[model samples]
Target: MAVTQQEIENRLWDAADELRVAMPEAQYSSVIFPLMFWKYLSDTWEHNHQTFLKENEALGLSAEEAHEVEYSTYQTFKIPFIHPGTVAERRASWSSILATVTQPGLGQRVRASLQAIETANPDKFSRLFGSMAWASEEVLSGEVLAAVMQAMDRTPKMHEGNMSHDVLGGAYEYLLKRFSDGSGTRAGQFFTPREVVELLVEILEPKSFESVYDPTCGSGGMLIASASLLKAHGGRGYTLKLYGQEAVPDTAGVARMNLFMHNLTQFKVEVGDTLKDPRFTKSDGSVKQFDVILANPPYSLKWKPWSNDPRALGGIAPQSSADWAFVQHMIASMDPKKGRAGVVLPHGVLFRGQEASIRRRVVNDDLLEAVISLPPNLFYNTSIPTVILVFRAPGTKVPDRQDGVLFVDASKNFIKAKNRNIITDANVSDIVAACHLKMDAGDESADPTEANSLSSRFVPTTEIAANEYDLNIGRYIKQAAAEQEDLGTLIDAYNIARAERQKTEQRMNALLAAAGIEGFDE
Candidate 1:
């Protein structure tokens, strides 16, 4: 029987439990991700390697013949499964290292295998293992490492026969989410909530064969969501070209692992500072545009100001915040003919004094398309309100709406969570539908009233100019979320608050009990 996706996720999370005593919850990702990836490569290679031998066994092929087949037939295969060193040699592959769990210097053995695997497949696994040196006794204890391997070993076989790519990919996402939940604010560096990613991808609507890019692609969630959206629409997701750049080297590895888990081979996730040294650029040092671009970039990060870069179309952003700088880079990266972009930024960008000139230039050029004010507390990093700023190639759709920008005040459209708010599927649909009405007003016969809902409206650019180009939601939309809080919603909010309080009390009681004090009653 095939391994169910949920079962695989459960087992993986249990394996993560083995690391609780080994390191802090925030640091589990560095250890867990690499271990999971290693196991995947080893299991898949061993299964395929044996299958290749069996397929040719009718001719009574020898072991050497099978090794040749691994090269000649499976050369183009995504998994570069160079036969691992045997148990005696104690070299590359997960199984070889797992076998030495009882031996001394086990961590060193695991490190050697990782190095060997990277060395064997330079193109695919070049820096895929990343710079983390945690596979050592000095970092992660031998007993904990062994326990983790044993726990993972007991899970369903990771071969294609037992686990499909969808299940594998789902498991990877599950692990990412688990890591994110435990890591707190640090999680925002590599993980964006899936709903936020889905919202951005839906607005972009990337078609098959189109190129999609995320400049500050953390864990490649946005890129993965784009492919998933295509697949959901009965299209071939792997057909779309995916590109991204992550600042952290290990985080880039995680993104690469994520794309591969989804069986999306048509991707290139380079590691580097997107502003200082963008990896994907033309030979002339100009930004290479893509068909669709969306990102949830680092919020208001301080960086050395660069006034001379050609991508800085309007002017230099102050050293305080590089939010507009990322927007400028996206502008330079949008294709002149058919490109469109949606970026998640702090709402302050709508009227911040420092970025006023850049915002004014972008709006005057008719590049700004829509401003969506999302619910607060949607991100793990910060609770500050944010917006999705939509942009298009200057001439693509301005003639349709006579230079107008769509404003959506979805600030109150969310389902409450234990710690933060969540954008429900219904909310996402409502927001996306409103955004499309304005964009398709000229091309499609959109309802007149549909475009001017209580929560959203298409504002003329002149009105925005008169208001000093302040795209604040309160300025245009009469009511936020456009729906009164009902009794059911109020009840749900109360229940969520109660649940959070209960959890806090439980934690406090447990700590008190550990110190031999009386505990709180339920």
Candidate 2:
């Protein structure tokens, strides 16, 4: 009756493995994922098509005629209303079915089909069926392909119905994780680690009816996860207004599909470089703000340097690193009344002396709320230690937190995977809880055992200020390790004395040799 979450995840993983037969895992991911997506739309369309028939039955039209009208009414793709076997006397030859589905004209039909679905629920259905090039060798024939289709078909109907969002969404996320795991360094393009995303979402705690935005919203995982958080916290009464931007066309399409598959129809997810060619709109080309924002931008990516529009996040982020530019863009999008933002950045942003002006500007303006240093190998691509910077506009009231910043040293907490490190749920929850706590008295000190009072205790802003404003977590947060020095060792000094004594004797011999050559030396 209902497919368990584990079953669906297992089946999807098995189905995804089908592409491994013909292509490398990384290349096959593009081919396999899109097809799985196609099959999902195909199945859902079959269901919608049946419901349309029941409604049109009283009109006395033949099944085929009524199906046409129904497809038009719903803007759904017109696959033969019935399953190919059920609709035809016998299944058309496999080659013919392939040919029919792969015909160039079929692309238009598919697009139209997806477009109609979009009209019904613009946010959720608009772009779920992306363009399919079925004739490609990547999809033609193999045990893998066959097995994938069968596995997808085996997914319990319940996962596709009432519990669809949680079950299927998580399954797709699992697929993205698998793709990232397989793709290695290349995976950095879209997938962010789940633990890191959880830490950010927990800190932001986006509420229902609040708009959540990701400028570089790859695959919309951050958006989806935030929505999931809201759901988990009894936020169904509130709406998650989502907005996102991506530069890659294929990825943008995928992001749209991801939201649609989860039944999100009203959200606006657009395509374009958020830094140079922003797609989100404002009436006068001014800044736009959101209630909550989250992003994991490409580390140290360089943008076209010439266009320094202040709207481009204060124009011209450092030539070497675009961290602040992303920060500026995110800040611009924050809701003026109560905007809160969190971003993952390299530790360099906290205190590189080169951008002293910007550093002072951010800290002096007092917008920064917290910085959490993540462990090395936390990222799929690089081993560089990273940090999450939390920001909020001034004058906003937060429980137990009025001003200053929280620097969490989470760099030490993670489980090592083959290539990188990962934070388990326990780690994520603990970090989130600590963030909610009032800064412990002496929290800023190196020693964890220090205590403080209500009025006199809390993390000091002065320490962060002293580190030349570097925001690296190691600078503020301390790990427990005892350093010991050798109690008594004159090894280096004694070695110097021995060397001097030997040199003095050699000089004495040199004088004798100079006076009597070989004989004096002897």
Candidate 3:
């Protein structure tokens, strides 16, 4: 019987369910992902080892020599065989570790095996398992660990012949989505909604061999989305060099795992605060620019980098909000000739009083390409409205939007999914098409009527200046007028109301005279 992709996912979720009883929902990924990845490595290594033995049996090579050749041919990760003093105590691969899941000190042995793998493959797997704290009995009991391992083992082995890359990658992505959904507000910290990521990648349209980066990559979804887009267009997605910097260690580890599981080897994800200690820099100490930059930074964060390594292109963002600070860093890091960026930020950044100066400088430089207003409640964290700011380097060829900016009023476009809203595939396609049309049109004076028909319009820089550089979509895109009433009918109704009032006043005066109230009658 063949194992289906759906069956694989169901089994993985069942394994995750075992953790739910012993750990918080947010910690599920830390434990489950590492274990699943370990199993994958173990299965692949065993498959290769068996093939090497069968083929090299007549080559007169020792087992040790053949194993060395097999290790050299392994593509993804390298796991070494254990060389214990006694054969009875020997433990080599992931299978050796799984054999002890039923032992007395299961947590300690599992942790030791993970540490050994990391130590053996320092270059590739250094700290790759993250600080999962899996060995601590206080964290996860031996009984729960054994049950979880049993559940995972029941699934089809993720070996080279048994599982394809696409199936495995899709299953990993499904687990990520499930974890994000269960994580609540914490999901927003490391996960960008898939539809939103696809929309940004589509707008950027990364080509073959082009470089793509995200300064604050959360679980590396945006980077993967770019490669997937290339693959969808019949290009070799693996050729693209992906780079990212994440502030959190655990999130960075997750990002690394995500890329590796997707079969993306040409990538680098550094761990550090991008604003304070940027990892990617040129020989001259300036930021190394990329072809396409995409990011969804933490909104309105307060940081103290202004005193040390401030990014003061437009103006220093107040310590209360680092939104403009991130924008400035991205702009400075863009490739001078072909660089472009798409960033997701709170809508307040467009018109906030504190960021007015930064907004003015960015607009005046003609780098601001478009401002897209997205639907509110689309994120898991908060219900505040958000916007996607598209930018092109000053020297780039953005004809239609060179002297103006495109405003897209997509605030009302979303599909309600339970408590949250989502931008569907149709919505993403429509938005991306509208952006391309505005870019190709290039006419600042294009008829607003035709432009407004699609919920988007081009606003000249002069008009934006007149409004004091307010990039709010509502300020530029006018709503249609309400239906009007018939003029004659309104006038007739007014006259009838006045006549009725006059007749009532006459009756009241008559009653007042009869009551001998002279002043009232007057």
Question: What TM-score against the true fold does each predicted structure earn?
Answer: 0.87, 0.76, 0.87
Q: Please report, in order, the local distance difference test score of every candidate based on alpha carbons.
A: 0.81, 0.66, 0.81
Report the error of model 1 at residue 412, Å.
Answer: 1.3
Candidates 1 and 2, the one with greater TM-score: 1
What's the number of clashes in each of the models?
A: 0, 14, 1
Candidate 3 lDDT over 237-345, as tens digits, reads 9989999999988788888888888889899899998888889998988889999999999999999846645457767888888898999999988898999999999
The segments of candidate 3 whose C-alpha lies over 4 angstroms from its true place after superposition are 74-76, 81-83, 86-89, 308-310, 439-454, 480-522
**Residue 235 error, candidate 2, Å:** 0.7
RMSD of 2: 10.5
Candidate 1 residue lDDT tens string, 352-405? 666778878888888998888888898877888799999998798646555878
Candidate 3 similarity to native, TM-score: 0.87
Report the error of model 1 at residue 343, Å. Answer: 0.7
